[model samples]
Target: MVLCELKQQLDELLALSDGYAYCNQEVGRLACVQGQQEAELTALHTSIEAQNQKLLASTLARVQKEGAIRKGLEQHQQKLVAQDGQAEVLKQQLAASNLARESLSTTVTTALKKLALATSTQAQRVDSVEERLASLVERQRECEVQPPPGWATYLERNAVSLVALAVAVFTLGLNLLG
Candidate 1:
């Protein structure tokens, strides 16, 4: 019975190790995704800021140049119209970037929640397994010091030798299985 329980615990340990490895891999992947999203969001904000500055400069230039030049008012108006179109285009791009940022933020949040849950669940399982192993070890010690009623032959001197040989063989078999 002890050997079977040991084998079961070993199997559980193996499975837990595999799950731990998989969780680590998923956490790494999520981290990479978050990093990439942050970089992209930062770059988008930079682009938006630069475009706003450019728009402001162009507006100021148009105001100053409009008053200074009268002979080519028609050409100035055409240039103003072109600048207005570019500004509109930049506004649309900024809106799209904001939308993309929101979507990525949601994805990152969900991934973080899932990773946290998986980590906690694995920790709980590990703790439970450790408790079970500790209990088993304590029980083994008790059995060795005072054999159970079913093992009453332990009171005989020759039975001690037989029981010791059996234990040695069991341990050897367990080692081989392990």
Candidate 2:
């Protein structure tokens, strides 16, 4: 009976050892799973950080580009403003020049009218003087052709007076022409 009891006790010990071995195997497998999960979590964090860096860099670059565009637009606007001012000045200058030209043209027209009137008056005066001179010459010729009985002595005495009269008429005509 003692031998049978000892055999039964040995069988119980073997069973307990088998259970402990199984528990240890399960613990080792669970540790391996935990390590794999940690590695996956670390890789996921690294990927997220890389994406965030790319996004930040792109955002910065975009902001710089927008700022440059805004600055260029401002400069262009300034240039347009300056050009507008210059155009206004040019418009004013053009208006002044037109007014001056009109005034000058009016002056020239008035001067031309006065000159034409003076020329017409002068021409009439010259014609009247020429007609008077021609009549005097005709009278002198008629008197010379038919002298009366005392005409010879009278002509000799009045010859100097007649010559003076002719010279005066010629001088008067020249003065009028000038």
Question: Of the candidates shown, which would achieve the greatest lDDT relative to the real structure?
Answer: 2
Model 1, residue 131: distance off in Å is 1.1
Model 2: lDDT of residue 92 = 57
Error of 1 at 134 (Å): 1.2
lDDT of each: 0.57, 0.59
Per-candidate TM-score against the hidden true structure: 0.38, 0.39
For candidate 2, what is the TM-score?
A: 0.39
Number of the top candidate by TM-score?
A: 2
Superposed Cα RMSD, model 2: 73.7
Per residue, candidate 2 scores C-alpha lDDT tens digits across 23-135 of 55655565565566557656755765675566557556755755665565556556656787555555554566556556655655675575567557656655665565566
